[model samples]
Target: MAILKLSAAERRRISAFFTCLVLALVAWVITVLSSSYNYTVKEIITFKNAPLKRAFHSLQSDTVNITVKGTGWQMLLSKIREANHQIKIDLSPLDYEDFVVVSSQLPAINAEKAIHNQIIAITPDTLYFDFTNRSVRRVPVRLIKSIKYMPQFTQSGLSIIKPAYVTISGPSNLIDKIDVWHTDSLVLKNINEDVTTALNLRVPAEGNISVYPKTVQVTIPVEEYTEKTLELPVKLIGNVDYYNVKLFPQKVKVTFTTSLNRYADIDEELFEAQADLNLWRTYGISTLPVKVVRMPAFCKLVSVEPGNVDFIVKR
Candidate 1:
């Protein structure tokens, strides 16, 4: 490595040159920011202090494009600020109309006074909104969930929702059409145990519609299932005139699977197995298929021994 030393005058000149360069860069930035420029931006419009008895339904527009002229710094700050430009329209003094113009009802903008941005023009300066009579109703809430249980597991009882219903307040037309509200779709696969979760309800984009309880708690009861077998008598259906009908197997073994809590509640009498004799009389078929006429709701029929049985008729 070689060391080079500079004279005092040369070091001073180098230092002054870099300082001037930095100053020039700062000056350029200041000039660009201070200069006035025109820019177009989107502003969201929101209403406040709406009448309790009346609801503001369909709005002609929720946003408007406004052209503003101000310094570059002012424009940049406005774009980066977190505050939203809102226009409040007092509805207490206004009468009910099919549509109302918002420009005339718009209150003065006091929040933007500090920004010092001149509003050149606002597109669709005349805003319009549809008004309707407000109404409230209590509607049931339904849970939307896709659930699958593992092997040997089944839902024991009905699924319960903490708050079975919700209150909705909106336009009379919209409220009359809504009978129920549903939660967001949820999926649970291979669930072996009970599940409880809180889910949000579906929210409409319409500004006039509103739900009192936005979220609800759902509980799914699951239990282990056991297989049970029962010997049920097979009755002969239809009339057998002048002929004695005898099935090879008088009784059938009805195998079913149900939750443990409901296993003892099931019995052979709950199920009805019968073979139709009309088929044999009409078609002269010796073998007839046995069908289960009734069964418990909680019990799932697995199989029926000797699904088809032969009948012998002799006088």
Candidate 2:
């Protein structure tokens, strides 16, 4: 191996040269990235101000290619944001004309671009629509839920939704097909307390179908549950053959869980323990299955003690 020794002055010159090279590279990058440029991006098309008297179905597609003019900085961010964004166009013009020019909406579209980006042109610059008879109807809202409750906690009563119905307007054929509008799934996890929240209705799949009051208020009552047990008198049923029949066990212990608020009001009167005598006539079995046929509302049945009882029949 060979080593090259340099003087102090030589070392200083080498350091200065390297420093100038690095500075020059950074300045070049900044100048290039700051300059203005033009680019193209794809965007989804949406409509605003649809006419009420005339139901319309767009004949053109729901997409467009937008040519944008902006600095280098906007070119980097526009592509990412454009994918999630839709360019809304005014449909009021469709009242008189069947087609619309995208150039007319450039000013309004550019106003929302905060990155100094301007829309230059859009492919398929004209939008066209087909007309049909319009119809309107009011339909009830059916809420969908995917919820989980903590141990011994559950929903106490029916969920309440404000403005129970939503109005839908669209082509006559489409309007007739829709019956009830459904809300987006209301999801909750390990919920122990009452819930009051706003939920959005499902988005219309067709371009012309419109729903009013897209959002609804939902309230669900939640409560912790406690166990209750009662000795209910067992009744016999299905002895139509007129044979004297008797069951050894006349009562059963019914165990169930109910909300804390309803625990006091729940009693044996609300429960029904039954033993069917059809077993003795049809299957000729000595044991009859005892079942709880009725119970209080919002109560969960845990078990029925003495599930089977011995029975004797005299013909």
Candidate 3:
């Protein structure tokens, strides 16, 4: 094929013609998008202002289509946000009536709408509910955590949560099954010292359940650990027959790591090592596994010098 080349002056004219075409196309889009248009969006319903005396559950699908008039730009953004947003419906009227009008809450819904958009109608404009005995219960907050501690450091005690219990109010059938409310995951990395933070309560997927005080304060006690070793006398356990038995090694060394604050106080008295005699009585084994039955909650057991003890039973 032969190559075709253009002069500088011809190239300039060609580029300007193409640029004008692009400009005209862009101008058309701006005008079209600026025009008012009506669009429909499906928004999940979030019930608020629930009735105090009655427990209610939505009888119909939780989703509703909202018809709104807005500029094309607003309609475009609303479509992008449809899956991420919800409309709040007041259920306070459910105290006396079984239904709520969605249009009645338009003022509240309009406040949360995107700029330059107006909601005209909500499909299934009336919300219906089924009633049951209302219930309010207090349940403990279970902390969900993802924590990594620095080497030689660990939690000293149970994490403390302010307002350890959250009040759950809903239909008895629903809240009754919930024993403990879990918090959103609290993540900490390479933590060497005590941590104090707040955690949000995980939202219940059920629309009827409500939790007051959305967040709880959490304090996890962390401290650097120090190793301690002690020789503890082994006591024979599971000796129901009280057979005359003796362990070859009556004592075993216990190695554990404890917080510096408790290292000085954690002694042999705080720990008890026992050898299970059930192995000798039931299975007729000569060796019993040595286990520490009691230890301070803050200590992490490392190892026992003699993991098993040899026992002899005499008639």
Sort order, TM-score high to low: 3, 2, 1
List residue ranges in candidate 2 displaced over 4 A: 1-39, 69-85, 110-117, 279-286
Of 1 and 2, the candidate ranking higher by TM-score: 2
Model 3 ranges with Cα > 4 A deviation: 1-39, 70-86, 105-117, 237-245, 312-315
Order by lDDT, highest first: 2, 3, 1
lDDT, candidate 3, at 97: 91
lDDT of 1 at 121: 60
lDDT of candidates 1 onward, in order: 0.79, 0.88, 0.87
Ranking 1 against 3 by lDDT, winner:
3
Which predicted model would earn the best TM-score? Answer: 3
Q: In model 3, which range of ten residues has the least summed lDDT? A: 76-85
- Which stretches of candidate 1 lie above 4 Å from their native place? 1-15, 31-39, 45-56, 66-74, 77-123, 132-138, 169-179, 240-243, 278-286, 313-315
**Per-residue lDDT tens digits of candidate 1, residues 1-315?**
999899999999999999999999999999999999998888776655555677666456777776778888988888665275644444444345544454444335433434667666666766556677888999999888888899999787788997999998888988899888999997899999999999999986677777878999999889999999988888898855857878889888889889988878888778899999999889988788888889987778899988988888876
| Native-structure RMSD, model 2 | 4.1
Clashing pairs in 2: none
| Angstrom error at residue 83, model 3 | 10
